[model samples]
Target: MRRSRKGQPVTEIFKQLLCFFLHGTSRHLVFFDTLAKDAGYAAVIESESTSMLSSHSVKRFFRSFRWPRIYLFRHLLQRMFLWRLKLEAPDVVILGIDTMVMDNDEAKVRHGVRPTYKRVKGF
Candidate 1:
């Protein structure tokens, strides 16, 4: 566990690992602030005046960076979910399903679609 200037506990390793998505001081997204807020470190980050990065700058570092990889972000998210699942269910094999139906009627060339669901027996 790492702490912010005001002594709030944060997963510093995770934050450093995520820095791979940022290119430079001017090019990045405002994700860290949101992360800090979500992870309960917003107050710590906000109070760090002597830090190299202000709270807003730290959050938006990705927007100004060059050629940040989006795939890395996606992969990190997937792995984080899997890791959390393992931590919560160390000895159990959990299976789950998402039954989400998106409104894709506007798509001109949808890849996969059942013209009609046999189970629903409708259009």
Candidate 2:
């Protein structure tokens, strides 16, 4: 994995990624290109001393993570979820699980492509 000078704080990166997913827009890394041009998003994520990272930087940041780091992140998230559940103690709780198959026939050269039951190439 390639590492560069730390540009944005991890918190800020998480905020940007969360906002991007919550926006219900295209689920492509290329969306970062459009976001780089969105002043409104910059205003929401940027601070007086720090600016949003470029699309390339964002992509690089994600590419640096490995399976061990991802599993650690998942463990941390699960612990946080349990803490929140204890604090809230709601009468009812609902959990959801879903999977999405992204079609990648046009980009067969990309990694992780495989045949799916949907009769298409995807990841």
Q: Name the top lDDT candidate.
A: 2
RMSD vs true structure, all candidates: 10.1, 7.3
CA-lDDT, candidates in order: 0.48, 0.76
- lDDT (C-alpha) at residue 13 in model 1: 32
Off by over 4 Å in 2: 1-6, 45-50, 99-123
TM-score of 1: 0.30
What is the C-alpha lDDT profile of model 1 across 1-123, one tens digit per residue? 223356332344335434524524433334444443443343433433233233555444435343446676677889998999878987777689766555566667666665444333222
lDDT for each residue of candidate 2 in 1-123, tens digit (9 for 90 to 100): 334455776777787888778987888878877877777777776533235556787788898888999999899999999999999999999889797887778883957656885777876
Candidate 1 deviant stretches above 4 angstroms: 1-47, 52-60, 64-68, 90-123
Range of the 10 consecutive residues with the lowest summed lDDT in candidate 1: 44-53
